[model samples]
Target: MKKFLSLILALTMLLSLVAVSANAEDITLDVIIAQYGPNTQEWFLGKGMDGSNFVEKFEAANPGIKLNLEVVSWNDLYTVVSTRISNNNAPDILNIDVFADYANEGLLMPVQDYCPEELYQDFFPSFIDQSVIDGTVWAVPDLASARALFYNVDLLQEAGVEKVPETWAELEDASQAILDAFGGEVYPWGIDMTTDEGQAAFAYYTWGNNGGFVDENGEWVLNSDANVEAIEYAIGLVNKGFTNPNPATQTRYDLQDMFAAGKLAMIIAPNQLPTYVTDKEGNVNLATAGLPHNEGATSSSVGVMDRIMAFKDDAAPDQAARNEAIGKFLTFFYDPENYVGWVSMEGFLPAVNSAVGALVEADPSFQAWLDVLGGAKFYPTTKAEWNDVKQGVIDVEQQALTGGNVKELLDALQAKIAGK
Candidate 1:
């Protein structure tokens, strides 16, 4: 830890003498970190996870660079960011899920402009691929999670489900068996079509059926035959009394609670399901399996990742110097010494390979999640039309839940996205 002491000494001198060097100009980065949960605010600014202050350490490491960091809840982040962007006062660094809008709008700096090459190389290649538009990478993943089928083991055993369903037909049969055993006391399956996670509902079935938001060429293909069939099958499950009664209103949180309480026999959820259940004091024998696929289709693990991106600042006098400072910030943030806690604290999988061994050491369960994440298929966030497609699929599902034609709704969405 000699390096740590050196940083401390540098910071002490910088504070007392007010300058590390005559040329060391002070730089303050305005950063907005999304509040993922209760402790995120404390992790970056206060005495939170590990009781080590991130800002203090970062500043000490690089004397002249100060962090004016703000933690914004997900609810207010979009509004706060939008207001700032419109006012041409965007933060130097931002953490959020969707970045295509900012990137396409020319509001974000290319990752190459600020990301350290060694640090950039440490990021998972697949994860980095998701943030690229054309040939340029725009952001880096903060954390990632894989979605899979979580089943109540005791409930399934009692229901006579001999094996975890691997295909849609088997899933339907298992669902029916659970229905027969529970007699309406427990939902055989949980489907979330609420606005909060409706897009995810689209992914569960469509991606499972080998029908996804885009084609192999990354073009919008929402109304393809495969997608129509997938959506129809999902709606069929709800109609057949095999799923939760109110798919349109029941959110992921609601479904998670039901699953934890043994009220839902099966649900598609992330790796953090166990952590969530434990925290909520819900008891159940839970096991996970890949999402069931349709016949002749693929069973794909759905991966979810939120990103950290830097914004363009045309007003900066020294772009290279500013980018270097940003690089140092990233380097510090993802250092295994700091990143392992950030990922583990949030109960998420790491986006960088450097944090893997440490995370798995801390929790063996992380290894299994890492395995699932390896083969996972991500959303097409690289596409400029991603937000529209995300919301469009949700709308299509909500309408179909209300008896609208799934095929017709998807066809309409396809045309809308195509500007037809």
Candidate 2:
């Protein structure tokens, strides 16, 4: 009788296993992506906003799983994501750049828990280093862009400038000559000292000056002499009528528009300017160089990244399956042939060495832009207080640009960030 009871219990367990496996045959992954507007190319060939047709192939290869994608703008991303997270209804995957903050809040799963070590090794070492916070991989890099000096060749020539400026003094001289040559009819430079680009531009200038927001010991140095000098120099350009006079009211897009209209000689922007500045006539005589730095200082550009991250829901019944699907999708996404197209279409530098080789062979024009990535410095976005600090910095910068004292503004900002 005891043996008979044991046999029945074993049969029940086997039946339950079969039922669970059958249930796992059908899976759906909810995803949220940031829309880059119409100009943004979709690397994946798919029916919906995810843009890659890879979804169909993925589904065809794995019949049980489906990817449901929703597109959100960068302006709405945090708000929507936060609301979802607060409601305990976050998506399976998100394409975003704020993983560090989310990771700090315990809202993310370390990719290393799901992705293979070999897969992680395929990423650029620096990028991989950046994605890890508190010793865990929070996000996977999708694309990266480094800031560079984009100059209108024809405009520079018209201003009697023989070459693009390589130092702060040369930049000042070039701007003065351009303004004088054009009789102040056109802005000589388009320094975007607005809410959108101010912090980034400031970082580029500070980094180019061989200074940054923090020191090697992670101290807040917002009011460092180099930073103060850089900010003041930018403001001086506006006061001198070389940059857009009302930069506080303008945005980076507005600056780019002004540049595209041939009304500005130089603008410091990400490598995407080439894609943004072209007209129906084909392309402009755009020339690229590293951002100008203080004399005798090492030059650096700011690097921006977009990442794809997977989430974990401990309460979900199909958690393991979902994670497995995510691993598979990431592996598929990073394959050289697919990633190379993504790099070319998305207008970002390749995150892996293989993609870099493929991209160079496919598009040689990106060599200068690629060169800038070597000296790219990043804002300290890993800090839990990063978003708030960034907002504070932007506010202070806007104040400084609008006739407030740079030292006073930065001092206040430094105090606030330090307190945070």
> How many Å off is the CA of 326 in candidate 2?
1.0
Q: List the residue pairs that clash in candidate 1.
A: none
- The list of candidate 1 runs beyond 4 A from truth reads 1-24
Candidate 2 local lDDT, residue 310 = 80
- Assess candidate 1 and give its TM-score to the true structure: 0.92
- Model 1 lDDT vs. the true structure? 0.91
- In model 2, pairs of residues that clash are 44-51, 44-52, 44-53, 45-52, 45-53, 46-52, 46-53
Task: Estimate the lDDT of model 2.
Answer: 0.78
Candidate 1 lDDT for residue 93? 95
Worst 10 residues of 2 by lDDT: 40-49
TM-score per candidate, chains pooled:
0.92, 0.89
Which 10 consecutive positions of candidate 1 have the poorest summed lDDT?
Answer: 16-25
lDDT of 2 by residue, 263-331 (tens): 777888888788877632334688888788899998777888778888778776767777888887777
